[model samples]
Target: MTTANLHAPLGAVSVLRLVDGIMNFKTNLVEWNESRQTRKALSQLSAAQLEDIGVTRADIDKL
Candidate 1:
């Protein structure tokens, strides 16, 4: 095979890897943001309010 043929496949594989990395990063970021929002919402609840939902401030960190 010629040098051009080998380089073409390598270039395509690198592009695919770059795209996959970007997609994985985006998915992780979205999940992290959602978890952060949930934690924030739970932390703002009063003790009674938390108990009504059967959750405690200490347990909130585990979620």
Candidate 2:
């Protein structure tokens, strides 16, 4: 309808969207990596040690 609107393409990528995607990627990577390490450590504990902390082997990934 307008000059700017008429010039716009269907496949345009905005700066805000690009920045948001990068930020989200970094956040997810950090969170997943931290959770993986924590789950690994919890899974390594003996059953008794796990009970002392009030978590069972089945609960490791659930947390």
Candidate 3:
């Protein structure tokens, strides 16, 4: 095969790898941000509210 034809599949593979990396990064970021927000909101709750949900102050601080 010609050099040009050989490089075509390699370039396509590289592009696919890059797209996969971007998608994985985005999924991880979204999950991280959601967990951070949940922790922050839980931290803002009163001790009684937390206890009602079975969470302690120590648990909130740990998050």
Candidate 4:
């Protein structure tokens, strides 16, 4: 079996992981914002408008 080097600097790996986590957070935030906007717009629609789009008031919250 090969001996592992325990003294290696893991700065690069740690930085990459941190960047990945930040990017994931940003992506999720954007998606959530978009979903919120969609929900808001749907909620503002009249019954007839919602019916025209084949969506109901209950569906808005489900989305």
Candidate 5:
């Protein structure tokens, strides 16, 4: 009976770890998508436009 009780908590912990992993994956995907969109928008800006926003042409590729 004691061993059965221990197993139940361990099983719950395993499920929690799986849920955490899924959430981390989702967070990373969203960050990557936002970064890509930012780069795309930056690329569309001319040197003057970029400078107007305080971003240099050299900075665009770096971002």
Candidate 6:
């Protein structure tokens, strides 16, 4: 990126890059939250329930 000069103004390119970065960040954050929630729900299941799905308690963290 070029340095912002006193005589030069920012262009639409810089604005678009910033907006794209913000959107990517927001999407990653949402995915992380959903994954945590799914892990929590899986942890709440009983051994039998987990077995029915072929998952063991020790496998929760690996997921």
Error of 3 at 52 (Å): 0.4
Prediction 1 TM-score vs. true: 0.74
Cα displacement (angstroms), candidate 3, residue 51, comes to 0.8
Error of 2 at 52 (Å): 0.4
Each prediction's TM-score versus the true structure: 0.74, 0.75, 0.73, 0.80, 0.77, 0.73
lDDT of 3 by residue, 1-63 (tens): 645544556578889999999999999999988889989999889999999999997887666
Model 4, residue pairs in steric clash: none
Candidate 3, residue 29: the lDDT equals 96
Task: Choose the strongest candidate by TM-score.
Answer: 4
Where does candidate 2 have its weakest 10-residue lDDT segment? 2-11
| Residue 5 lDDT, candidate 5, scale 0-100 | 45
Candidate 2 overall lDDT versus native: 0.87
1-63: candidate 1 lDDT, tens digit per residue: 645544556578889999999999999999999988999999998999999999999888886
Candidate 2 residue 30 Cα shift, in angstroms, is 0.4
Misplaced by over 4 Å in model 4 are 1-9
Clashing residue pairs found in predicted model 5: none
Candidate 5 per-residue lDDT, tens place, 1-63, comes to 344544556578889999999999999999988988998999898988988999986786676
- When 3 and 4 are scored with lDDT, the better candidate is 4
Error of 4 at 47 (Å): 0.9
Please write out the lDDT profile of model 6 over residues 1-63, one tens digit for every residue: 887666535676788889999999999999989888988999999999999999998889876
Pairs of colliding residues, candidate 1: none
lDDT of 3: 0.87
Q: Over 4 Å off in model 2, which ranges?
A: 1-13
